[model samples]
Each structure stands twice: as C-alpha cells, then as structure tokens.
Target chain A: MNIEWLSFLTVTLVTLIGSLSLVALYSFAVRLKAIAEDEVRGAGLAKSGAVVCFVLCGCLVLLGIYLIVPQLGGSGGH
Target chain B: MDLTLIVVLVIALALFFDFTNGFHDTANAMATPIATGAIKPKTAVALAAVLNLVGAFLSTEVATTISGGLINEGDNGFSIGPEIIFAGLMGAVVWNMLTWLLGLPSSSSHALFGGLIGAAIAGAGFSVVNYGTVISKVLLPALLAPLIAGLAAYLCTKLAYWVTKRPSGLSSPKRGGFRVGQVFSSSLVALAHGTNDAQKTMGVITLALVASGLQESGSHVHFWVIAACALAIALGTYVGGWRIIATMGTGLTEVKPAQGFSAEASTAAAILASSHLGFALSTTQVASGSVIGSGLGRKGASVQWRTAGKIATGWLFTLPAAAVVGALAATLTYFGNVGLVLVAVIGFGVVLLIWWLSRKDIIGPHNGVSDVDEAGGAISIPTKKQRRKMRKRQREAERAEAERMARELKKAQKNKKKEANGKTKVPTASGSKSRAQEASAPKREARGTKEKR
Candidate 1:
C-alpha cells in the first residue's frame, strides 16, 4: 500500500504543536490569574497578562473551528 | 413503486443509524468535562446536542463521498442497490448498539464502512472492495491517530501541571480556570464530531436517492435529508449514551480539571488537524487516547489498562464483526421483498431485545458513574481512593470469614471429642425421648454435686 508518509508526519507535527501550545497558553493564563490574586505587586500587570493569554487561547480555538467548517474556508474533507 | 418503497426503508434505516452514531460518540467530547465536574451531565449533553445540530449544517463537501473511496463505486464496479445499503445500515446499527451496551467507545465510521464492505462483497464478490484503501486509509489511521493524540495529551498534561505548580506554601490556583477551559475544548470536540459524522448519514441517504433514480447522482444533498439527519442525531445526543460516558469518564482513568482540560484540548486539536489534512481518524479513539495519555502524564494517576484493553478489542472487532452481520443481512435479501421484511423483523427484534436487556441494569445521567462499579472493572476502573476502599472492604470480609470458619472448626472438634468418650449419644427414633431425658438427668446430677460442694 502507498502510505502517505508525508501527510502522516505533517499531521503528527501539527497536532503536537497545536495541542501543546493551546494547553500551555491556557495553563499560563491560569498561573497568571493565580499570581494576580495572591500577590499585591504587579497584580494589575499579571491580570492583564492573563487576559492576553486567554485571548490567544481563544484565537487558537477559533483557528481550530475555522479548520473544521469547510464553508469557513477549511479543507476538512471528512 | 417497489423500488421507491425499498429506497424509503433504506433512508429511514440510515437516519436511525445516524442517531446511534450520535449517542455512541457523545462520550468522546463530553466525558472528560463531566467526569471532572466541569459540566453537569444533563447540561453537557444539551450543549453537545445543540452544537451537533449546528455542526451538521457546516459542510457538505465530504457528504458526496461518504464511502471514503473504500468501495468500488466506479462505472465498471459492481452496482450497489438500495437493498444492500439497507443491509449495511442494519449491520452498522446492530454493531453500534452492541458496543454502546458494553460501554466500549468503538468507531461508528468503522462500523459503517465494515457493513458496506460486507454487503458489497456478499452482493457481488470480493472484487467490489478496495483492500488497499481499507488498509491505508482506515487501518493505518486507526493505529496512528490514537498514538499521536496520546503523545500530544501526555506532553500537554505535563506542561499544564508544571505551569500551574505553586510555591511551597501558597495554594494552587482554583481548578475553576481549568474547568472553564475544559468547557470550551469539549464543546469544540462536540462540534467537530457533529460536522464529520452527521454528513455520513446524509451521504448514505443521498446515495440511496440517486440509486433509485429519484435524484441526480452529482446533485447536492436534499435539504430535508440533511434536516432529518441533523434532528435525529441531535435527539440521540440529547438522550446521551450515559453507559459509554461513564466508561470513558471514570472507567478508563481518573480525570481532574487540569487533566480534563489537557485531554480535551488534545482531542479537539488532533481531530481538527487531521480533518484539515484530510486524514480521517475515529473521534472516539482520539478522545480515549487523550484520556489515557493524561492519566499517564499526571504523576499519581493510573490508567485502567483493562478498560483500555476492552476498548481496543472492540475497535479491532468493529469492522470484521459488523461485516459478518452485514453479510448475513445481505444474504437474506436474495429472496426479494420477503427477505427484506424478514431482515426488518429480525433487526427490530434484536434491537428491542437489546433495549430490554439494557433496562435490567439501567445507566442514566443520575447514576451513570455509580453504576459503572458493577459492570466489570473493564468498564469502571476504580479511582485510587475507590480502590483503597474496595481493598479494605475485601480484607475485612476475609477476616470475618476466617473467624467464622475457626469457630465452626472448634465446635466440630469439641463434638468429636465428646462422641469419642461416649459422652454424647446418637439418638434413634424409638429411643429419642429416653435419650433426651438421660442427657438432662446427667446435667441435673452434675449441677446438684456442684451445689453440695
């Protein structure tokens, strides 16, 4: 059988990066929120940083949704 | 007219299969969130159902080729009729129901493909199947998808825990944040499931229409067909496959909010990425793999390998088992309408029987997880605390049983010594009254002597 090794590799790479980054970003956001709540110094900055991390995570989720729905210019041919 | 009736029956059966597909896979997206208490069971299923309804309207590109190039549908290939499709649907439905009852998260797509392949072969020899496509597309992906998703989830889980780790004295962040993240990630998985799976049924219905000459082969799916399929699936999702949900949520592994979030994110990412790359994988397998990976990633968490093994076994058997059932159903169709009616009767009867059996040990939203304990450790792997409790209970029971046996043994020994000394007599029916009086008289004499002393 002619297995598409290239495609397989691409999927593995993309899934790892995509999922790991998303989880990391969300974790970072949670950490920031905790820091903001626990400490007085730089609380405002930490809270804002948490917001940024959350926005990034949300964007990644949107990107995922974009890839799933074909009408939204996705190549999901399942 | 007869053909029309047959086509109608196939469409109806296809819709029912779609319903099963929805419920069988509800655990794929909702299990983690529910298990972690990120979402209530009823609310989680409701959200999944709604998302699935919306997702069914998202794409129709793949709906035109639901077979995924597994069947030989070219002009020179064997012509597959509506009857064959009917038989295939029956096989898929039966297999799906059986797996759900056993609470194994097998692939609905595999069941569908296996059913079609089996029916096609039974109808027109083995040449009608593309074994290469089966191997490359279905088999290979099945093996790889879980591994990739698991690795991603494992690493992601470690990262989540590391990032969230706190200083020596301060408390860790409330898992409420991770719970919120889980809600979104699980929702995405649900939406993706709806988009991918609902189309398969729509495609089957459209194929039946085209085969019966009611619609053009290249034309778009009918709106009514899409709508009916969407509703059927949504209803099924709302009903929820609580049994499978219990297995996935609590049986395979213990899921905390952090692990739940990581697992869901990995599942959503893997599914979206694979679909975007046109690499088809079973959503059920991906989710289960993620859960297992998260379990391994957590420092103290343990995966229930027995449960995982059961799920893997189900996956291996899904295709061949469904194919056998499909072949049997197709073989019956050779006798024409009488055969069709008979297949229907037998199919419905089996469905009813399964439903009846399920009721004997019902699993619903209220007691889904609680009931898992009795279904076998393969369906409900006890948590560490639960395992400890069970072991303690087992030890206590063993001690109690030992004490009882010791007491019984001592009593038996005492009775044997008495009989050897002739101090105890075996009573005969004729002398029973005299024996009882004699025994009492000795006891009275002993009491009198003790009083005099």
Candidate 2:
C-alpha cells in the first residue's frame, strides 16, 4: 500500500519548476519592453536573458522527454 | 482457423484510431497559436506533427497503464480478449470522427476508455473492468486536470498583462516577444500531446497482442507498435482538423498572443505532469478549459458561452455515446467470423458516411478562423494572398466592363456612319429630282460649270 513517494515528488517538482521557469521567461520579456525605452545595452542584455530563459524552458521539456524515453526502450517494468 | 488474421486486423484498427486521434485533437495544441497569427496554420500543424512524432517516442508509461492497468488480462474468468478490444477501438474511432465533424473538442481519451469499458463489459462481464483504476487514474484526472490547467493559465495571463501593461493606445514590446514565445510554448504542448496521447494507442495495441496470445501478458510496448502509432498520428496531425481548430481557436474566445502563450504553457505543464504520473488525461479538455480560463482572465475579453456550452455538452455525451457503439460492436463481434466481417463493414460504412457529411462544410487552413472574430468581427483582414487575389479579380472585372463599353461604342459609331452615308445618298437623289425641273436644273448647271472653271 505504500505510495511511490519518489515519483510523486518528481512529478510535482517538475510541474512547479516548469511553470515557474515559464513565468521567469515571461518576466524577462516584460523587462525587455522596459529596457527598449532607453539604454540600448540594457535592452540587449534583457533580450539575451529572455533567449536563455526560453532555452532553459526547452531543456525542461527535454527532461520530460528523457523521463518518458525509458518507456519506449521497453526495458522498464511499469 | 487462425488467430493471426484477427490479430493483424486489430493492430491495423488500433493504428487507424490513433490517426483519427491525432487530427481530431491537433486543435488542442496549435489552435491558439494559429488563432493569434503567431504562426501560420500550415506551419503550426506541420510543427505540431513533427513534435508529436518525437513525443510518441518519449513515453511508454501511459501505454503500460492502458495495456496492463485497466483491463483484466490472462486466463482470469473475466478476461476480455482481443475481439472486445477491437470493438472498443471501433467505438472510439466512430466517436472521434463524429465530434470532429461537429467541430466539438470532445476528449478522444474518454471515448477510448468508454469504448473499452463498454466492450469489456459486453464481451465478458461488468467484473472485467478495473473500477479502482478507472476511478483513480482516468476519471479523477479527467475532472481535475482541466481545472488545474485553467487556473494556472488564468493566473499566468493576469501576471503577464500586469507586468507588460503600458499607457493607453501605446504599443508594448511584450506583445511581439510573447507572439514569438507562443510558437515555442505551443510546440511544447504539441510534444506533450504526443507523449501523452499517442501512448494510449500503443497501450491498446499491446493489450490486443496480449489478449490474442501473440505477446506475453505485461509485456512492454513493441517497437513496431510504437512506430506505427507514432507515424499514424503524425500523418493525421499533418492533415490538420481545421473544423475543430476553428471551434477551439476562434469559436470559444478570441485568443491574443499573450493569452495563447499562457494557455499553451499551462497545458504543457499539466499534461506533462500527468504523463509523468501515468495518468490517462484528456489534452482536449485541458486545452479547452485553459482557453476559456484565459478568456475570463483577460479584461473585457468575451467568451462565447454558447460555443463553450456546446463543447461541454459534447464532453458529457462522448463517453456514453462511445460506450453504446462499443457495446453494439461487441455484440456483433460475438457472432463469430461473420460477425467480425459484419462489424468491419459497418464500421467502414459509418466512417465513410461521416466523411461525406463533413464535406458539406469543409474548413481548411486558408479560412480556419474566419468564422469567429476575436474583435467582434471588427478584424476581417484577408491574408496577403487572399487580398491580392481579390484585387486581381476586381481589376479583371473592371477591365471586362470597360471592354464591353468600348465594343458597344464602336458598334454605335459604325451605325452612325451608315446613317450619314444614307443621308448623303438621299441628298443626291433629291438633287436629281430637282434637276428634273428644267429651270432649276439650268441654274444648278450654271453654278456647277462656274465652280468647275
């Protein structure tokens, strides 16, 4: 009757982290807007930050794929 | 005399259902992006198709859950065999096609589940269903996932607007950036869709293999099954369900780029989490709920309640209707070899009829979102190609009218010249008649001679 506590923790953590990372990426997009008004260097920095944040989000998706890939190899017993 | 033939038939049917599932739910992931002009319709579907294929290779957990967790397998008294599985799949495929024709975003997962449950019960008994698993894994997730995603999207949308708010009538740089981000977020949703949805077919196919004694019980999804299901769904996605896409993208609410981005992000999060948890969730319901939530989240955004109600009603009917079809198909399958052939023939007929009905109102990429306007029909700008085509047609019509007028004018000029020639002839004839008068003719002749000299 014991729950798979580890799996539960992984799912919850991934969901939270994924959502928060998206929010952070959006915040960077917002910052880029404010920076575009003045200071060209600041805008460039914010633009790069947004790109990095987006890439990080993509990495999270890749992590999701990694977790799911084991099922495809037919090696893991469900 | 052979089970192998039925096994092959079941596998083919499973793949076909997977294909229908792909196109029917393409709107769930790509609708918002296409609606907001963040990506073109063809490009969005193409991207979704490729990602969905990759996503299929990503997860096997859900497949195992479907194949092993739901139905009673082995020589147990309640074990439902491969024939029931085939009937269940037929039920699901029929329902998916019906909903797609109606442009309603009903859950394909629910349809499959209902069909399986129904066919299992009809073929074996009510005891064949794993109620605990159904309630815990399938039912609970179906109810909760959408609300969770909606709430997540609602908050995300509110926060996005608050952070990017600008002076009235001024453009915000955030809009352009979010539009670009939408392509990325929606792609994730598409991938998550592949991870979660394509696995369901693989699971069902594996279950069939087990039931038919082709594979051992509790065996992993076969590589061939995975590849077949993935390729089938990908091809379906490429075809694009424009009807459902229109309903979800524009019918429910007008989606701005920011709203589209948040909704997709929320959908991806919810679906990926559920996929990881091995929950058989409905991405269609989750995406639809998120769209409605985003609509309600935005200030002054109007949700088409009627369209939303139609979708909700479809969701309610999806399970029972599919169950009925599954039961009927199972009953037919019980008739022996002839029954299987009969079921196949009838299933094909019904599918063909649905396709024929759909032809009455075809929705294509070019006009997918034209019916519903986010701006209350204020924005009906045609695409550049459409506009150019319209202009060209208008110019051609104008030129034709001008040419007709010119032709008429030329004909009139010729008629006028003929009348003038007739008048000149009449004058000569009158002069000849006057010459018959001797005195008048002498004066006329004298005038003529003087002029000639």
Candidate 3:
C-alpha cells in the first residue's frame, strides 16, 4: 500500500477504536445509573457516578469533533 | 541501528509510558463511584477503562503543546533522538509505577514532561529548554487547574442543591430526570478523558519524531503520530488501572452520587476546555479539584482534610521530584553504553521490588479494601474515627429498627383486640402471633445491611 494510504488506514482505525470506546463508556454509564436504583444503595454516589459519565460523554462529543473536524475553535473564547 | 528502526522502537516505549498512565490515572476518573459503591468495583474499572480509551482520540492539543512548545527540536540544536526518547519514556513510566505502588495519584503528564525535559537537557543543553512554555502551559495549569475545578465543584454542588432544594424528597428524583442528567455529565468526563489524557501520548510521539529527525522542527503533528498515540493509549485503557482506582475511589473524598456527579462534571469541563486551548494540564489535578469541590458542595461530607493535605504536597513536589529523578537517570545514560545497561538493570530491579512490596498490602478492588480502609487504616491500627462512625451508624440503624418494630407490635395488638370484639378490619392479622414473635425481621434487615457495610 502507498504510504499515504497506510496513514489514512491508521487514522481510520483510530477513529473506529474511539467510537467503540464511546459506546462502552455510554453503556457503562447508562447501565450503572439504571442499576443504582435497585442494586446500588447510596443516593449521592449513584447520582454522582451518573453525572461523571455525563462529563465523560460531553468530553467524548468534544473529542468526536476534535477528531472529525480538526480546526474548530475552543469553546472558551480565546 | 537505522533511524527508522530506532524511531519505531522509541514510539513503542512512549506507548509503554501511556499504559502506565491509564493505570495510574484511572482513579482520577472512577474513584468517586467506587468509593461510594455507586458501581461495583469491576463495573467501575471497566467503565473508566473504556472511557479513557475513547478520551484519547478527543484532541491533539496536548500533543502540540509538548512537541512544539515544551521542547526545542532542531538538528544541531536541541532535538530528541530516538535514544533520548527511549530514556525519557522509561523515566516517566518508572515514576508512574513508583507512585502507583505507593497508591499516590501523581501526574502522569508531569512525569512524561519531566522525563522529556530531562532528556532534552541531556541531549543538548539547557538552552533547548523552553521555560516560558513550561511555566505558562504546564506549571501554571498544574497550580491552578485543580483549584479551579475543586472550587467550581464546590460552588456547583452547592448550586445544584440550592436549585433542587424546593423538591419534596431528598435525592428522591421525584421524576427520574436526574438519572438522565447523570448520564450526560458522566459521559462528559469520559470524553474529556479521551480529549485530554490521550493527547499527551500524541505529544510524546510527536516529540519522538523531532528527537529522531523524522520530522522537521515546528512541523505539525503527522497523522501517523496521532494514530500511534491514540492506539497505544486506547489499548492501555482497555487493560485497566486497578491500584490507583482503589486509592482515589476511597482515599481522597467521601463521595456520594450527588457530590461525585458534581466533581466529575467539573473535572471533565475543566480538563477538556483547557486541552482545547492548548494547555497541558494534568487530569489528576482537575479531578482532585472536583472531588474536593464535591466535598464542599455537600452540606457535610467527610473531606479528610489531612489526606487532601498529603495529596496537595504530593502535587507540589511531583514535577520537580520526577524531574530530578529523570535528570539523574539521563545523566547516568551519558556514562556510555555501560551506564545505560546498568541503569536499565537497576531500574527494572527497583521497579520490580516496589511492585512486590505493594502486593504485601494488596489494597485492590477484589479485597473490599474500602471497607478495611474506611473501617480502619491499611489493615492495622484502624482509624478510631472510622470505627466511631461505624458504631454510631450501627446504633442509629438499630434505633430506627426498634422504632419500626414497636409501631408494628402496637398496631398488631390493636388488631388482635378488635378481632375479639368481632368488628375486625385488619384482615392480614392471620399471623399476628407469629409476627409478634418474629418482630426481629426489622433487626435482621438492619444486621444484613450492617453486614454489607
């Protein structure tokens, strides 16, 4: 394969890898949150774990943009 | 060796740096839940692992900071060769393991930075070091990031409660909207993990390029570097980071779901925002802030101020401490190939020794170390404070059960009397005598929960 093609392939692989991770993280967050009501006890801990996942989600969304679109400006006005 | 071969090898070593990073810093993301038992240990780690992997592909801002800003990379000036890259990665990786073995959450980003700085200084001279960038990009953020995140967490947590104050039942969810809110916030943290922590590896790979003369100085990060960094870090996250998870989950804060949510949300926002702006802040520090903030956010959370003090002191000393060690190792490498060989042997031996020593304590997810730590300290000479809390909680639960039983017994007697009068309405009174004898149901439940505790 051409060197350019190899590099493209690599980037594609990384994107897929990232996508899979996001799926896993989202599933964990949702499942963990669902279970908190019954199996998990603490009200405070369950809520926090959930939001922590949300933070992770937002970060992932941002990351998706960062990967798909390279030149987006910072959200915080620079 | 050929330059290309050396380059590949150095990149692999940088990946080794990343794997340790995932393991060492997993606690920063997942500790709050594991400590509070919002998620089981296995589930908590598994979640953190995947999120961290996804987070690595989020951005390359951190990479640019390291490759272009932190170090000077030019031929005949201050470039990091494959050899220096190898040595630097080794230094960073070693420090990560050392801290993990001790169960301290030091900055993996700082360790790598220090190693790279040490290697650059060794390869060329102090002139190649960009102190300004180090201060503004790395150090200043190190100082302020956690504080900002923590303070924000405190304020947001307070505000979250204030906003929710008028609601009827505490954490009652009344409608279950908060569950949806939680999913949103936790995902942000995981994504922030990808965007920020993963970028550090990208920087390392880019730095290796400059060092090995594979890329021109001041060049943008090549796609290969980005891919390699992403792949390595993602793989590392998949493997999981159990030791640091234990420490962070329990050691830093008494995390409840509300506080954990606030802290993690605060941390994710702080880290990703900073990363995008090209500030290479440590996620550990950001997470620490959120945890502390969560403590302040809750009306009365056990902040363990003493433990926070130790962690703060650790943060203060991590960069310089790792820098000193990195410099020492780099200096040793200069004593020719013999020095390199000796350092390698000695370093590996010492790292293995530390690992072995850590196993003696074996504070991990499987052992219910949280119960041991919260119940006491390090399996011996347990904290009197924890013991007191346990006793108090036990007493309260017992009291609550007694009240419940007394109420039940009174109602039962009333029903029994009414039945004799033939105006009975409490039809479930068929087992009144049995229930009176088995009023210990409440007590048994209390005991069961206590057993779990």
Candidate 4:
C-alpha cells in the first residue's frame, strides 16, 4: 500500500511479463530449429531468427534475476 | 532473556519446516518433466534444487506479508509468542509428513497457515488472527489458483498441439522438441517455487523474531534468515520427494512431452503471478490442477479420476488436520514448561513413528513408478491380504513353471534312453552320465529358485 509495496508489485509484474516473453521466444526458436535443416532459400533466415531468439531468451532470464535481486534493487526491496 | 532460548528453538523449528516444504513440493516443478523423460529424476531434482536456492532470494514481499499481515504480532497488545509459533510449526510438520506418507500433494502453505491460526486462536483468542488477510490472501487464492492454472494449462495444451499439428493430427517432431522445452519450463517452475514457497518460512521466522523483540517491525528478512532458509530448502529439494513425485508424475495422468511443457509453463506463470501479488497460495494445488487440465486437454488421454479424487480429498483435509494438531499443541503448551516439553517429546515421537512406518513401503526408483499407477496415486506397503495374495499367486506360477521344466527334462531323458538302448545292448557309462547331468541341471536350477522363494 506504500511506495515499497508498490515497487514490489511493479517488479512482480515486470518479471511475469518477462517470463512469458521468454517462453514465446523459446517457441519461436524451436520453430526455427525445426526448419534449420531445410535446404530451401529461407534456411538462412530461419537460422538467424533462431540464434536471435535464443540469445534474447537468455538475456530475459538474466534480467529477471537482476530485477529480483534485493542487492540490485537499492535496499528497499522488502 | 528467558525468551532467548525459546526464540532459537522456534527458529530451528521454522527451518526444519522449510526443509520439509522443499521436498514436499518438489513434485510441483519437476514431476511432469521426470514423467515425460525430459530429464532423469535425479538430474531434474538437482536442477530444481539449484534454481530454488536462487529463487529464494528473488523477493521478500510474501515474507513480509506473512510476518506482519497474517497473524497479529504488532500494536493490539496481543503479541503472538514464540511458544505458540513452535506449536504451530509442529502441527504443520506433522501434517506434511502424513500427506507425504500417503503420496498426496497437499499444500504446505495451507498447513502452516492453518497451524498458526489454530494456535493463535487457542492461545490469545480469535481476535488475534487477522481474518480478512486470511480470507483474501490465503483462502481466496487457494480456491482460485488451481482453477486458473488448470484453465491456462488446458488452453495452452491445445495451443501446443495445434501449432505442432500435421495433417495426420500428430506432431512427432514437435513432441521431441517439446521434451527438450520441458527442461526449461520445468526449471522455471522450480525457480518460481523457490521464490514463492521458501518465503513462507522466512516470514514465519521473522514473525517469531518480532514476537521475541529481536527485530523491528516492518523490516526486511534478515540476511542470515534468507541464507539459512534458502539452504534448507535447497538441500531438501536435492533429496527429492519421490513418493509425491511418483503420484503426480504417473498416478494422476499419463504425461506426454507437450503436456508436460504446457503444465510447467502454466504452473510457473500462476505461481510467479501469485508470488508477485503477495498471495501465499499452495504451489502443489496449482501444479496438480495444471496436470489434470493437461490430461483432459489432450484427445484420447485418460485421467485416473479416482486418484485425482483422492488427492482432492487430501487437499480438503489439509487445513483442518493441521489446525486440529496445532490447537492440541497450543493447549498443551498452555500448562507452561512441562507442557512445552511434552509437546516437543510427542512431536518427536510422531515424526519417528511416521518415518519408521514409511520405511516398510519404501518408494525408491525401482518400485516408486510401478506401484503408484495401480494404487491410485497413494502407494503404501501393500496390505497384508494383498501381499499374501501376491505371494500365493507368485508361488503358484513358479511351481507351475518348475513342473513344466521337470516334465520336459523327463521327456528328453526318455528319448535319450530309448535312442541309447536302441543303438547298443548296453549304454556307454559316459554317455548315460552326461545325459543324467544335462537332465538334472534344469531341474536343479528350478529347485534352487523354488527353495529361495
């Protein structure tokens, strides 16, 4: 109900959204991987997309960790 | 400083409860993954253990809610003492062990809440508990979390199938992909579990610290409290809850890779959302519901509804059972020093009894998976009648097999004797001796096994 509570709530929301996006990117990466073996002209495009999504997913998880960390949240995280 | 001893005891009890909580709920995160063979059971737990340790440090909002919001610990002059908390913890831990013995994934959070409520009501009267917070933060979420997670998982499962579907309506390649995806999704659930479930103990410990006047009201969890709690939970997680895992993984429904992925993802989302909202819901209920929903989502998949019903019954009983024990413990403690010692002694006895009884029907890797499905999710040592019947049937089969082998050996001997006698007036001693040995070998082997049995 106060600023501290509000900030915690905000952090929770951010992390929730972040997790969902990571899953979505994972799904995209899987699709790209499925087609990476294709010999078609689009194979290059698929490979790049897969790499980008995997990288993004990894970054999202790290960001989530950073956001949840009390030390990184300046001391009012409770 | 008379309270110092009691405060340390309470903190130790809180950490013990946290350890039980970790193992009890490991099924929530890793059950589906283990069931689907996305990861080996041992490896899955190790992964979950590390993630839970990390997740425990994620947020303290729920911990604050527990310490300050649920039980009346501040200004109303009705401070909950360490003695009451200790009794409550004993209540919670006993219920946890009972449910685990039955392989039921009941809510540890509910047990804790119920124990505290009962203890508080007994010690300080009903006015000491903040009923509004219990209703909104605990009860409402308890009722809603499973339903929401179930619905989400059901829809997500359908989506998974649809996206991966071919003209034949089967997604074989996609199945392999999802099995790999299950590792990630389930790990997320494990991390989410640590963030949510471990905090309940932190909150309880913090509450006890406040009651003993060791910490200020409205303060964050102490660093040592966080570290100890995280370690307790992580170590417990590493040990794994194979009984509950067996029940959730194979007893409730047959989990495929896609279903596993969907269920894990849905569970992670619901738990994370609840944790963020500061709702102390049971992750077990959410995970169980998600699994059931996924089962129903897939076409032609059958749910062991009887097992599901039993689990539901356990969930309904969890709160009241813990509360009753809590109340009794609280009443015992009311008699002062002797009563406190008596409660601890009785609690220790009960814990040893449960553990001793559980050893009779150990659910290790060999028998854990196979026994659960047929027993409707709750596997204990087979009853005397059932075990006797099994033994009788096994003996009958072995006897029948041995008799058949004996008959075959006799027939072969007869044929050899006729052939030998037909060839010469007197059979060679060496040939007859070799034949006798060959004929006796199989019979001897069969006799040896029968005697062993």
Candidate number achieving the greatest DockQ relative to the actual structure: 1
- Arrange candidates by DockQ, descending: 1, 2, 4, 3
Model 4, chain A: how large is the TM-score?
0.68
What tens digits encode model 4's per-residue C-alpha lDDT throughout A3-77?
234533443444335434655676667667766754477898888987898788778766655655556863323
Q: What is the C-alpha lDDT profile of model 3 across B153-270, one tens digit per residue?
A: 6665665555434334334433233334444455567667767777887887777777666677677888766666666665665555555454554344334455456656666657
What's the C-alpha lDDT at position B49 in model 4? 94
Tens digits of lDDT, candidate 2, B150-197: 777777778777767766555544466677788888899889889899
Ranking by lDDT: 1, 4, 2, 3
Full ranking by TM-score: 1, 2, 4, 3
Q: Worst ten-residue run, lDDT, model 3 chain B?
A: B370-379
DockQ of 2: 0.18
Q: Which stretches of candidate 1 lie over 4 Å from their true place?
A: A75-78, B61-65, B74-78, B102-105, B215-222, B241-253, B277-280, B300-305, B364-453
Better of 2 and 4 by DockQ: 2
- Give every prediction's interface RMSD: 2.2, 3.6, 13.7, 5.1
lDDT of 1 by residue, B1-453 (tens): 289889889988998888877866676677667767777887888999998898788766446545335556658432778888889889888887776666565678888878877987897779877777677666787799878988998899899989988875677555569987888988988877777778778877887776666776568888998899889889888876555555553353346788778877887777666655544457777776777777678664445667667667768888889999999999998898898898889998888888887788877432343212211223233465876775676567656655665665565556656665784455433254454455456445645643442
Per candidate, chain B TM-score?
0.75, 0.76, 0.72, 0.77
Preferred candidate (DockQ higher): 1 or 4: 1
Each model's backbone clash number? 0, 1, 43, 0
